[model samples]
Target: MAIPTIRVGLTAATRTMAGTSAVPKYSDKENGIIATDRETGEKLYTVMIFLMEEDRAETLKVTVPANGLPNGLKPGMPVKTVDLVARPWANLFNGQISSGVAYRVSALELDSGE
Candidate 1:
């Protein structure tokens, strides 16, 4: 089944690079559980973005291609994401349900204005 992506806007949301880019929680080299792109087989990295909206504020951990993230991203620096999207995921494992919304972005840029 093809999952639909929901576009996310940062127009009224103030954002910042929360911390250094890191691998996903399931990424563990020792256990051979490294996370890779399902389509390209390329590795993936997660970026923490601090977002403040009108009624809600939370840090979003958005995934991006290993080579997609820009270099020299400083924490607390004003930033914006291009082609931001969210995908709802749910899986049944061990008779348990794991579900959440996953966020992704094509590019992350240091906001020069607005």
Candidate 2:
């Protein structure tokens, strides 16, 4: 059973926070839980990006490397993500199936000339 994924590219209007969900300690081996580099031990942070879809505005949460996000990235600033992927996740809770999309990016860069 392979999870389906889709490649995507988007511009970010804002970045909210960066941290791990694990309490007391953080590890690099956990998948779909904590994002981190295997060799460098650098943790990946979850970033919330505001975007415009069609005629409406929406927010997307993506997991990116700690150093991958640009410095001084602020609201209304353009962001480019390479190898951005949207993965579908499903789980059973209370005898019901729940599903959602999980986004991740391999690299992030500030979009200049915007």
> What is each predicted model's overall lDDT from 0 to 1?
0.77, 0.63
Clash count in backbone of candidate 1: 0
Q: CA lDDT of 28 in candidate 1?
A: 75
Compared with the true structure, what per-residue lDDT tens digits does model 2 show for residues 1-114?
566889875445433222222121134445445646666766777666655555576677777777666787655666666687899898998999998998877756776735
* Candidate 2: residue 88 lDDT (0-100): 89
Candidate 2's displacement at residue 16, Å, is 14
Q: Per model, how many backbone clashes are there?
A: 0, 0
- Candidate 1 stretches with Cα past 4 Å from truth are 22-28, 54-56
Instruction: State every prediction's TM-score relative to the real structure.
Output: 0.77, 0.62
Candidate 1 local lDDT, 15-59, one digit each (tens): 555565555545776887758787888778788888776777788
For residue 105, give model 1's deviation from the true position in Å. Answer: 0.6
